[model samples]
Target: MTQKQRIDAFVSLGNFLRSDDQKLDILLDNASIKNPWYTKNNVRKQLATLSANLTPENLQNWLVGYPDVTVDQTVGIILAGNIPLVGFHDILCVLIAGFRAQIKTSSDDAGLTSFLMQELITIEPKFATYIDIVERLSGFDLIIATGSDNSSRYFEYYFGKKPHIIRKNRNSIALLTGNESAQQLHQLGFDIFDYFGLGCRSVSKILLPKGYDIAVFFEAIEEFRPISTHHKYTNNYDYNKSIYLINGDKHFDNGFLLVKEDERLASPLAVVFFEEYADLAAVTLNLENSASSIQCLVTEATIETSIPTFPLGGSQSPRLTDYADGVNVLAFLMDHATQN
Candidate 1:
């Protein structure tokens, strides 16, 4: 098979995972048995974006640029469980690049991704051997691991000898102009609360203008009533609230979620924080210092200078298609073949 054909296998797997008629809803129902973040609406939304973004055209472009790629190499991924199918992107990336995938799925998200991998094998049987689940593996040519800052230390020690992409915890941020319209602010709500603010890409904090009314932020986010009502989310909200109250820490209330005022990148799952900024230049410097642990940033106000940023609601739905560290995946894949 041609390289594009193999990449197409990855695209087809994505489409199959997203099929409305598939048992995804059922799987999500089972997941909700453990954590109620698997609400039908949220799962459907997640699937829709992931499925739509992996179009045949996009997949073809992804492989076409990688002319010398091989299908025999193996890449290992230690997936993260903080968000649904968070590591699926890396799985598809390696597979589409014509490499075998040694997947160590996070326990919280393994079932659904494993089921999808099974479905992929059905589409093209030979591809089945290219993917495997493992309790322990060491033969991989490249490793892509994601973990907390603590676990990253062990991953670095163990896999430091190999070509690796080891990701530590990171969170998204938002820049507010205070002049944002209600619609723009509402989009910000999705960035913060989607995935119950568990994903690294989810915005955990915002840089608000000084004296910016917290009321506006609350009013905008209240539109996500379904998100607030999810039992899993409410559990986090209540748990974090109790912890804060017990410790005598202060947090602003938005009825459903807590807003803490802090200068940190990541907040607890059910809570968000905001910091007031005096100047954009200072904010940029702070972000630069913290860039290693930062993902995407959202902003409404146009800056005189442009930096890395994403639209308001694009956090929870990055494509299998998006290259990590802003490097072109197809080019990198082909380079491996050329170098060898």
Candidate 2:
């Protein structure tokens, strides 16, 4: 497909997602059945955010930096199913870069991605030949895969010989100055509660100034109490709360979420780990040491640090340029195109 054709197809898809059509209802129902974590409201919110970013202008701006090339290669992608449509961006990148995508969808998220792909094929029939949804990925010039650290070891053993971008487990963190406004802190709740903290960009841990009042942070996020109502989420919350209580661990609980002072980057679902920092230097040093495990550092204060920081609530709504794991996917594909 031509550049215009590709842009038009995505724009049509964005419009379709924005419309109040019954098709979305059906898709959401199927998605929820496939994975209870994909509640209808969560799926709808995620799709709406993605659709807004799929505008023609955004697509053009994102593509303008890359060299134009006509190349045909099969790119195998192993997608993660942690959050709703988490792998859509990779598929979009592959198509826009003029490569055929052999996608192995995570069983938890296959229905929604397939539905969107069918919509795109309807908009531009040529895409039907460029896209393939497969049970297994093989015979590809290059590969991009996302999985946990354990699975990444397996991916490395299997796909290491081929040029690939194999992404392992990474979690996001927030740096709190203890001086943020109520609104900013409230928005931080979305960073935590959205997707039930399943995505790599979700803030699983936080760094706070010494002696910060933890209660104030809890109060700011009271609006998100409804998250506890989800049966699956409530089960995790209750189970974690019981473990903490039975073990005599001291942690703050607001009945919906738990805040524990732990020096860990990866937090359990229904829990947000926090650490007290003596100064900016300490936080910077800690982040530098943990660079490999951190995906995003959300904050409002300006710190002289190399870690990429997004404002509170912006982690989940990444622009097209926000490549996962800081890998320049377009450049990677374009370079392969040139070599091929």
Candidate 3:
């Protein structure tokens, strides 16, 4: 299929997802059954974000920079299942670049991506020839894989001979300059609580100005207390809280979430790690030191830092061009497409 055809099909699929379609609801239910993390609300939220990003204007803007070529190579993608529809962007990149996708969906997130691909084929029958959901990813010319740091080693060992992009574990963080408005801090709660902070883009840590009142931060995020209603989330909160209490570690807990002074970037679910900084220079130095482990940074301040920063609540709502791991996916695809 041509690029326009691919774009049109995706746009239609996005519209169908936004509509009150009973079939789509069933698909969401099935997805939740396969992975409890994929609750109906989280699935819908993810779909809505995907729908917004699939517009004709956005797709055109994203693909226009790449050299168009109709390369007939199979691209193998091993998707990550940490969040709902996590791997759809990779699939979109492959198909839009005029290549075939041989996908091995993460077992935790199998149903939704397949359902969406079938919907695309229904919108444009030609896409049926371009997409395949395979049990084993073999006979492919190149590979793109996402997993934990340990799994990345396995991927590098197995797929090392082929052209590949292997992504390891990464987490997002936020910087608080002690000047955020109450509204901005409230929205920052969404960055932490959305999808129960399962996504790599979710903010698991925050850097606060030294002597900043922690009470203000807690009060602003009070709206998210309902997140504790989810049993799985509550269990994590209770477990982590117990661990802290038993160890006699001093932590601030507001009954629903825990905030501790941790130097680590990746925090466990139901908890957010935070650190204090004296100034922007210290924050920038720390971020630069941990750049490889950070996926994105959320901040409202204009700090001079090399890390990618988004507004307080915009981490999860990334645009079409927000390639994961800071890799230029389109460029990688085009470079391979041009090779004879």
Candidate 4:
């Protein structure tokens, strides 16, 4: 299929996602049962994001700067299952670039990803020739893989020689200036609690000014206390709280989440680490020093920082152009396809 055909296919898929479909709800419900982490609500949240952004205008704007990829290449995609349909963007990138995609679907999220692609083929039968769900990825000119830190080592070792985009574990950070309104902090709660904080975009840590009142944050996020009702989330919260108490560590506990002061970017599930900053420069330097480990920064638009900031609660709803780990998957494909 040509570039316009591919764009139209995705636009149709977007409309399909936006429509009220009883089957889609059933799929999400069944998926939640298969993997408790893929809660129906979380899957729908991502679906909503895709629905909102997959417009013709958004796709056209995103592609305007890039050259049209006329070269035909096969891309091997090893997907991650940390969140519902987490690897869909990579697949979309390959498809939009007019490359054949052989996807190694995550065992945790195959049902939904499989269903979406099948729907795409239904909308545009020609897409069937361009997409495949495989048990093992092979015979591809390039690859894109997402996994944890340890799994990334395996990916690097195996796919090193191939032109590939391999991503390791990354956690987002929220920088607080103590001037945020209750509504913003409340929205930040979604960044922290969404997907039960499993995905890299989740705000695993918060940066606070010294002398900041922790209770203010606690009060604002009280609305999200329902997140604790999940047995999995509750178990993690209980385990982490007990560990802290046993170690005699100083920490603050809300019913659903634990807040502790630590100089770490990645926090455990159900726990959010925080560090008090005496000066913004020190925090900026600290973040810069550890930029590789950080996925994205979340803060108020008005806050001045050396690095770019994502508005509060915007981490999860990444746009089509918001390539993962700051690597443009589509650009990578188009630039390197000639060599392949």
Residue 40, candidate 2: alpha-carbon lDDT: 90
lDDT of 4 by residue, 1-340 (tens): 7778888989999998888889788898889899998888898898999878789999898888666665577899999998888998898889988889999988888389899999999999998889999999889989899998899999999999999999998999999999899999998988998889998989999999999999999999999988878999899999999999999999999788899998778899999999998988778888888877888889983544444368887888888877788888877898897565
Tens digits of per-residue lDDT, candidate 2, 1-340, equal 6777788889899999999889988888988887999999889888988898899899999999676655679999999999999999999999988899999999788388889999999988999999999998878989999999999999999999998999999999998999999999999998899999999999999898999998899899999999988999999999999999999988989989999989889999999999998888777887988887888888998877666679998888888888888898998999898897
TM-score of each: 0.91, 0.98, 0.98, 0.97
Please provide, for model 1 over 109-222, each residue's C-alpha lDDT reduced to its tens digit, 9 standing for 90 to 100. Answer: 737678778877887787777889887876898788889899999999999998778888778888887888888889988898777788877889888878889898788878
Q: How many steric clashes does model 3 contain?
A: 0
Task: Name the 10 consecutive residues with the lowest summed lDDT in model 4.
Answer: 301-310
The local lDDT score (0 to 100) that residue 57 gets in candidate 4 is 95
Q: What lDDT would candidate 2 get against the real structure?
A: 0.90
What is the C-alpha local distance difference test score of each model?
0.76, 0.90, 0.90, 0.88
Candidate 3 yields a Cα-based lDDT of 0.90
Query: What are the RMSDs of all candidates, in order?
Result: 2.3, 1.1, 1.1, 1.3
Per-residue CA lDDT of model 3 for 172-232, tens digit only, reads 9999999999999999998999999999999999999889898999999999998888898
In angstroms, the error of model 1 at 132 is 1.0
